[model samples]
Target: MNTQSDIKLTDQLERDLIERELGTQRLGFVNDAKRVIAAVQNVFTRLQAEARKAKVVYANG
Candidate 1:
């Protein structure tokens, strides 16, 4: 039979692991964002095509 102390320790250990994994995931996301920001983009020209965005959300009312 597990005691209360054991249960508490297990809970704390799980939380610690989750926090550590989250830190690594966040670092990976930051690295990806930096790469995207460093990408090349064309300068605006006298004759440029209109930019368009896909309708991301549709409202049914």
Candidate 2:
């Protein structure tokens, strides 16, 4: 089993490898993708906040 610190280190290594593979030329595209991901995450957070305010309960079908 991986420890929390070990998992974080592995994730960092993977991100470093991907950045190296993408290189400077594609950095702009990577930045754009990051921005889009951030935007989606923000939307999800807002939705969760709204659901909590409305006392929503999630059910599995």
Among these predicted structures, which one has the highest lDDT? 2
Looking at candidate 1, what is the lDDT of residue 10? Answer: 97
* Pairs of residues clashing in candidate 2: none
The list of candidate 2 runs beyond 4 A from truth reads: 1-23, 56-61
Worst ten in a row by lDDT for model 2: 52-61
What is candidate 2's CA lDDT for residue 28? Answer: 79
- How many collisions between residues are there in candidate 2? 0
Model 1 bad stretches (over 4 Å): 41-61
Q: Estimate each model's TM-score.
A: 0.56, 0.51
- Per-residue alpha-carbon lDDT of candidate 2 for residues 1-61, written as tens digits (9 for 90 to 100): 5698899999999999988887975987889999999999999999999888667454432
Rate residue 22 of model 1 by lDDT.
Answer: 100
Using TM-score as the measure, the top candidate is 1
